[model samples]
Target: MGVFDGVVSALRSAGCVFAEEEARLLLAEASSPGDLARNVQRRVAGVPLEHILGWAEFAGRRILVEPGVFVPRRRTELLVHEALALLPDAPQPAPPVVVDLCCGSGAVGAAIIQQAPWVELHAADIEPSAVLCARRNVGPMGGQVHAGDLFDALPPALRGQVRVLVVNAPYVPTEAIRTMPPEARLYEPVASLDGGPDGLDFHRRVAAGSLGWLAPGGHLLIETSQRQAGGTSAILAAAGFLTRTVHSEEVDGTVVVGCLAAGMTQG
Candidate 1:
């Protein structure tokens, strides 16, 4: 059998659904036969393909995704789409400020700037590895990356100036995490996956703190599962935002958007 055939067989035997596609990608990444062999072994051992490739395609952009960092998922493109929809029209003196919380690899923020080059972007993550990786991706795009828990990572100067806030925080319940695919449960960090008991913990925190940071009439967008979308919207409403849920059947994605009233500029 040819080298490609052998690699596909190894990947298929290891339970990879898209064995042919994975073999092609693995072959493209391997510069030498030894490298190809090593990559195949790693794939067989269950390392995520994105982690092996060191990048992920999100919103048609190649986002740098380092090992141990949370890989961006295709569903998150819906969050980016909704956030872009909420942004006010362009052509202004000062560009609208955008902040991405729990930014991981900064895929969402990167995608935003890719479309709207005028945005002042900032991304933050609590994990050191994520912060470092995000910097590599967001920095080249002229966006800043911060390391800290949630809003704390952002500069104090950004308060009340943020026009758009996007978050993709952990939403998997502690108990439910056990049922997640091994690519997430085994490869991704627990802090990046666990969301306390009901998986709405970060939603509550982000919603409660969002009002003080959002500009007048600014919008907050959070990625969540369809099952948890209602709860996410309810939390935003309770925190004084005008909330709504948006879903994409094509991508099977859900996003909760909260808008601060135009009349209430300050908290």
Candidate 2:
């Protein structure tokens, strides 16, 4: 048997769900046998398959993802689909401002901008590593990326001017962390996956700061868990937003949309 036969057997034995496909991707990405061995060893050690490939296919685009960065999930495409539905195709009668908070790989904003080229897209993240990765994505698209906590990273002038605020922050509960798979538990950052006690920490912050930045009738769409959707909607409703929940059973994803009515908050 060749080296790959042993590697494939080892990967399958380790419980990789797609050992054959993974082997192909690894073999394609590796420059030599040494590199292939290293990547295979990392996969055998339980690092995410996407992390080993160095990119993820999201919204039909390839997003760069370093080892430590949060891997973009297929479920998050629901949030992107929801945001696209909320906005007009960018040859907008007038250009609109867009913000993507907690933008891990800048995938959401980049997807929106790609669909609507007239968008003035901006994205932010609390983690410096994510921020760096997002820059690689948003920068090429003429989008700006800031690194800081929530609205703190957004421009002051964007206040009451944003037309779409898309977010996919961490919503996994603290207590649930222990139950996650070894790849997520060991590879992803605690801050990127942990969402405090009830897992609405970022949702709470987003609701509190959203109205201040949203123009009259602007919308904020956030991805949350199905179990937490009701509570998240309540929080947004209390913040004076007209709220609704959109879910996709296929992806097992849920998103809460909060809209600021025109003249309800500010002109």
Runs in model 1 with CA error above 4 Å? 262-267
Model 1 lDDT, residue 196, Cα: 88
Q: For candidate 2, write residues 150-236 as lDDT tens digits.
A: 999988988888988998998999999999989999998988999989999989998888877898889989899889999999989
Error in Å for residue 95 of model 2: 1.3
Please report, in order, the local distance difference test score of every candidate based on alpha carbons: 0.91, 0.88
lDDT of 2 at 96: 91
Identify the leading candidate in terms of TM-score. 1
Top model number, lDDT? 1
| Alpha-carbon RMSD to native, per candidate | 1.2, 1.6
